[model samples]
Target: MSYGDEHRYGESARADDELFGGSGQTRTRLPDRAGDPYGGARRGGRSSSRSLVTVVGVVVLLIAAIAFANRGGDGSSSADDRGGEPAGAATAATGKRPVTTKTGGIPSGFTHDAQGAQSAAANYAVALGSTNMFKKDTRHSLLDLLYTPAAATRLRGPMDQAYSAEFLGKVGLDSNGDPPTGSTFVSRVVPVGTTVQQYGDSTAKVAVWYMGLIGMSGERSTDPVTSTWKTWTFTLQWTGGDWKIAADSQQDGPAPVPGDDRAATSDEISKAIDEYGGFTYAR
Candidate 1:
């Protein structure tokens, strides 16, 4: 459940020292195992035992070689190790200030670059899939903040019509898009990872893979609780020192085969959703 003491950046001073033999000498050893029955055998038996030892030694060496190769060269750093900066300045910015500014209670102010595009994509997926979008006022505000100026006005009316009173009722919400008195509404989005497909000085294309929760909870509920995998792709532009989405689209994807886990009771799902708060994501 825990990711251990390793930092998110993948840079551990202890790991580095261990890999390079910080004490100025590398340890060496011969391959041998105790309690071998062939230790004191006949001449032919001794030869066979030597062969076995040789095989074991080779296996050990191969494993060590593979480990070293996988770790990359000692001079290289991983993507996470380079910190969330534009690709060129990434390594030098490793210990730079964290990006944690908020706009209208939503996290924003990402640097204008690949890392910034990734962070924006992840957060935008959450906002777009949120339950608040079902309400008229909140939906408009969220769209205006997230989309480019041209797209915002164009999408607003269509989105409002899509989440109309009739649509809300079909989804188990009242005319006002609220759950019944004894029931609970649950909609949440969780980001899995981000990828930048294209990058430039002023624009970037990023995709976020995410799982979302939608549906209502009650004895008479339909569409009880389900998980969906969606890829949200964003075209982002640098404007006023921050990365902002220009256009975005969603597509179903890369979903795993469903598990056989038993479905939770409606009430349980409702209670859990109500009790838990969502996260503010960053890449």
Candidate 2:
């Protein structure tokens, strides 16, 4: 059992539920300023009370506004869900198409080859960092999809060993890779950005900066939830109608100072992890 075989948690999986709850659909009304025009002139006693209500109303509206904006692109048909604009439309919209016609299964033969490589690099980073890689079946499929044949074969054995049953147990999963009852396993990788250090007709070097979630959800779990910054560099080759990894490596951080925010409880963390879907990173 692999992570992919387990349920995918996150915002992408929340279509059936209202965001932030059904309260999201409720519109908050600020008191009519005209009606309260003279209210501010009231004596100190009522003034404080009125001001407090006004402040609370404003805060509610602010929260509602922010929630609405965040929900805008949450639908299934959004552009990011569909892998960006159509090929010819993308090419036509931006004259920056690649010069080479094809690199991998993705459009590589753009007039702007750099853009294509960057696109491939970003998507590759997402796929490589996905939870799916924890499962044997999905890992093999992903490796074949993203790596050169030789590299895939070479990596499969080692990857299997790395994600062995012991590792799964450490992450709070059973031998079949399922999270324990009432717990959620979180292992998501989100690319923060991407850059290309080198590009050519045959090869490119791309670096992806990402934040990853790697921990178990349970009261006694030692790992607890945490995030780390990493730079994944891929040396890619044009192979079999797509870009394939020749080699890859990772290094820690361009990290930021940790904030003083209190960590969430295990249940809250698990709920949040299940409710927030990942993104297909773009430049």
Candidate 3:
């Protein structure tokens, strides 16, 4: 199985038309948050200790009020220090800094909130779809930084199996995961937008809509580099002061109609990838 097949886990196969060319978009509804519905009743008791209990309750309430006030109305001030504004549309940037640190070349230290989750998901999409993911060392580093501990362990084996020697040959990569001397392999993911489908204090479901470029670039290349649009949904957990991927899935097209612009040549594409660098994506 290909990495696309294995990594997508239980998702059904998408059609070529849906994957490569399509109009409009499809939004997946996230699972609703379940609530605890059975709180046991407290037993009634009358004793001289009642007065002391009431005094402690008042002190606790005062402390909570001070904490809320310190947060400036909503409890998320720490994450959205600039104040969270409505995004208006599904694809708007939140106009806030998403992360401030890097670990093993992947972005780290995401704020503990929804915008932070969106940011982490977008950056991870770029990393996962990049040519670097074909190499074992860099791939392992990325996996460890971006995914939750359990998910990283579970996926490492299957993902290694999926990106096999045969698959490398098919994609024009050498056994060591390098492109031919005269050729350039492209596998960059550009995130166009992000949406928080569901959010909580400690978890978030975010989707990144992105365009990915893949294939080989050279005069003798049979599989010329091509682009595909996809929406990648990630389930994130607040762990170790950052958002980590708990799970993820992908679906095809919310793609727009192709433009009438002329296609660039193989040399031009290769030159561009080499000259241009990717951005630190934020939402």
Candidate 4:
């Protein structure tokens, strides 16, 4: 994405097209918003699903806000003032500055440190698990962008086979990665947090905890939108001054017990996803 192009975050209809490429055939309809952001409509009814997202956002912000009550985005406080947390223990939000430039709308040029590894892991998780992974063109573009050249060459064929037409049909999408007409296919990855398992001058192993949404939204759709929890561990290599994936794996998550919240209607789920953009996921 160029500086002149519209900026976006998260993999939704417009964002993916602008950042990666065509992800699907459907378009979003945002009917309400008091301020009319992109002509968006007012938010819909309350549901456990909606409340969960809101709560998570509040929690993350609250933690960052209270992480160092005496400190701020500007790092005025030192380790001596931080109760001397173990030298390498993951500290609360450090108010660390994020990279200012972007590559394909993806934050890039991470620092050479543990904090940089964590940030790269979180952002990469979101990009990899995005809807763009389904389409061939965008998938290739993304693989080129997110993976080390050698990794991209190694995974191309396997990834293409994995998202074969038959697999897409089972997931209610066409060979072209489009949902049935009148329906919207939803695929998004929302990162919860990141942790560094190992870090070195040339490489890092990092894990990302995330919640993913995948399904088709339509009045008569059989596969309604749903969510899943997983942790993705990525092996990142420092190449060309960027952290690119060398290898990655995923596993079932430490998912929280489900709350007694009613699932949102398809329209509600669809609208909510369209209205709420994803974050750049920085410290």
What lDDT does model 1 reach?
0.63
lDDT of 4 by residue, 128-242 (tens): 7777877999989888998889878867787777778987887788999988887888888888766555556787666677888888898878888877887776777898988
Which window of ten consecutive residues has the lowest lDDT sum in model 2?
Answer: 17-26
Write one digit per residue (lDDT tens) for candidate 1, span 88-169: 1111222333267888767788876566677777787787777777788887888778777766776676666666787788
Per-candidate Cα lDDT values, in order, are 0.63, 0.58, 0.71, 0.67
| Residues 1-283 of candidate 3: C-alpha lDDT, one tens digit per residue | 1224334431322321222211223344464585563555654566437956986897799799667633432222123222232232333345667777887777778878666777888898888888878888887887788888988887788777767777788889987799999999998999988766656777666767888888899999988988888777777789888898877777776789999988889999999999999988887
What TM-score would each prediction reach against the true structure? 0.70, 0.59, 0.71, 0.69
Over the stretch 1-283, how does candidate 2's per-residue lDDT look in tens digits? 2221122211121221221111001123564455544564556878889988998998899799767644532111112211222111111112232333432332233222444555566667667556676678887887777777877877777777777898777777776677767766777767665555555677666556677776778877777878878766666678765667766666667677999999889999988877886643333
Pairs clashing within candidate 1: none
User: Could you tell me which 10 consecutive residues in candidate 1 have the lowest summed lDDT?
Assistant: 1-10
* Model 1: residue 149 alpha-carbon error in angstroms: 1.8
Best by TM-score: 3
Show where candidate 2 strays beyond 4 Å.
1-112
Best by lDDT: 3
Ranking by TM-score: 3, 1, 4, 2
